[model samples]
Target: MFKLGLLIILAAIVVCAQSIPFLEESNTVAECLASNNITQAEFQELIERSSEEDDLENTERRYKCFVHCLAKKGNLLDSNGYLDVEKIDQIEPLTEDLREVLYDCKKMHDDEQYLCEYAFKMVTCLTDNLEQSDEVTEAEKNTNKLNE
Candidate 1:
């Protein structure tokens, strides 16, 4: 309920239709990390440092990669390696949508056709591979047997 609403808001914020507020609002690495969610602070700091370089295009490219890496790692609701089941539940919908946004950002940043194609393939592979992991397979088999 409340969690679902929070996820909807987060998805709206992350979508291509919406801008990344962290880039627009934050002035420092700390600020950016705080704004995006402290769970991603380390990666945000890395992006901030990369942006200090003179090349704006390079900065954007790196930032896109940073976002992709964050998404690949998982949702932002948990912190300090402790899973807050409540927070995790709250952000599940947003995390799912973030995966899509990260994939798109990776595609846009990948100038070389090879990297773009590779990333697209990687997206498919990660999603399918994750779904077929042992735990998920066992759960699915249990469900199928139950239904039968």
Candidate 2:
């Protein structure tokens, strides 16, 4: 019984170790940007412009345009009310990177008895970025200014 418990613990450790790499790579791109570990020149430009704009609504429109431009460059499209894509082509080469990371993470989970940490990190990173955009920030500012 002790040996069985030890084996289970060891299996869990191995799974966690393997998943670390997958989460590291897959979550790096967006997490870094959101955390400012990755410098986002495009987002900066939009944010700066939004800062200068007189009207929040117009600022938001421009910010949305900037996001659409970025998405075009990234070859990504709106999917499943989320980030879903009909084909990998929508994301260009980065699609392959995402796929590779996801596969590695899932392989680790299935063979090494890991859990879906990568999926959690990936979703969190994406959501964080989506929420931190200039439009959202400006909207918040507008709300605060109105309340005051």
Candidate 3:
């Protein structure tokens, strides 16, 4: 949950979304990865380096692709733009509404149009679409704060 939240926060840096508090409050890549007992500072450095040369749009796309690559390889997310709830359940079971949003976001996301903007864009949509009763997850709450 927090990993994906961190992804959106990191993505805001490439896109420079100032209105959102996510960027300000999120854990650094180094800190966030520690929670999972993973160590890969080089990955964050690589992503930062990739952002240095491109325009915002292209850089955003690169970041999305970078995230997509990680999620795909790690099996944390599916190509349909849904979080792998089963895999997440292996760690801990999530609420039903969180599951609904995951599937709904999967159906709503368009990889062709967004080109793998699932971490940020899809989560944003999911949070916005879910009502208060849906019991949005922590990641969804963070993502919902994204403006436009």
Candidate 4:
């Protein structure tokens, strides 16, 4: 239950409605949750807990599997249980920089043997990169404005 919630929260953090189309679909999330045997209440609780700093590292294996389920459903994972970089590059809202980061993250985890851990690590990598990317972009914009 906790893992399910953590996966959902991680998904939300890395790919909110503006970025990932599948995540915006309630049916998809519901299906993944049901398949994973995670109760809606537990999912909600985990989402709330996601705001805490330590949830990601403490997330359970079930939650990692839940993330894998979501990745499969979203067509983010290839037949080998690795991220499909080609498909990810086609996502309309993802900027080239973000796509590059995704590719790098995938490469970093290429040795993962478990699909669940792979998916979870991918999410974690994405969240960390996205946050850093946002900070960098904001800083660049501020610098550009000052220079102008």
Candidate 5:
């Protein structure tokens, strides 16, 4: 009876975790792109540009608007163009550290004017913070192994 109960609980956890939606749903992405009148090639170019560290500072308005569209679709942005941290906290598969980083980034960009710019800044900030966090984590693990 104990083993059966444990198995059932584990199975339920797996099912719940699997059901958690990805931050961007495919249908939502398509809808947002269509609404924004963005072609896949243009979107790909934006993605490539955003990936380049130096290009982030010069993101085009169209790219920023597309980001805003995605955030709006996901209900991640509040009425004032700021990130709704509460909504962000509910996204599953996000580590506690990542959540903390997100909250910090939201506060950091709290005064952004336009919805498009706010969304774009938040995305960039989160990406940079997460990358830094991963580097720090990796360094810590290496140090611990060395000490061991």
Candidate 6:
């Protein structure tokens, strides 16, 4: 069941990614740019003007590297090339749904682990789930107000 659920959600993320390709670009790209003494915004400017396919591919690779940079820097990635769930729990207040999302996202991994893709996918999944939780919390508050 969990595998099926993760597959569905990952498919959805990929579909959305097709429409906005840059949404697939993880923070790792930004981290990689720092080596060139470039800021995230500067990298964005550079990528935006690039028209060559090789350039895009190169940038994608850089983005992947950036993701690794972020995970390593934040201690988010474990030695196994997977997310350190313990570190995440220590750093963030995640609800049950968010934890589930994280678990599901984490299940999609390669031998190399592609921590950049994992981190970005996990980050986006968590952000979406957390926003839903916030909405539900706000709705509950409104309901309580009405009852009172």
- Clash number for each model: 0, 1, 0, 1, 0, 2
Candidate 6 lDDT by residue in tens digits, 10-79: 3223212222233345553344458536576755564454432232223354444554555565556677
Shift of residue 113 alpha carbon in model 1, Å: 6.5
Estimate the Cα RMSD of every predicted model relative to the unseen true structure.
Answer: 15.4, 20.4, 11.6, 3.8, 12.1, 10.8
lDDT of 2 at 94: 38
Q: TM-score of every model?
A: 0.22, 0.22, 0.41, 0.80, 0.72, 0.52
Models sorted by TM-score, best on top: 4, 5, 6, 3, 2, 1
Off by over 4 Å in 6: 1-32, 36-40, 43-61, 90-98, 108-113
Candidate 4, residue 3: Cα displacement in angstroms equals 13
Which 10-residue window of candidate 4 scores lowest in summed lDDT?
12-21
Candidate 4 lDDT at 125 equals 80
What C-alpha lDDT values do all the predictions have? 0.37, 0.35, 0.48, 0.72, 0.59, 0.51
Model 4 lDDT, residue 66, Cα: 78
> What is candidate 5's TM-score against the reference?
0.72
Best by lDDT: 4
**Ranking 1 against 6 by lDDT, winner:** 6
Tens-digit per-residue lDDT, 1-32, candidate 1: 11222222232233212234433454433343
Structure candidate 4, residue pairs in collision: 3-63
Candidate 5 lDDT score relative to the true structure: 0.59
What is the Cα-based TM-score of model 6? 0.52
> Which tens-of-lDDT digit does each residue in 54-120 have in candidate 3?
3333433544555444344344554565456576545346567657666676676644455456555
lDDT winner, 4 or 6: 4
Q: Clash pairs of candidate 6?
A: 28-66, 28-67
TM-score top scorer: 4
Q: Please list the residue runs of candidate 3 whose C-alpha ends up more than 4 Å from where it truly belongs after superposition.
A: 1-7, 10-59, 79-82, 110-115, 118-120, 127-148
Write the candidate numbers in order of decreasing lDDT: 4, 5, 6, 3, 1, 2
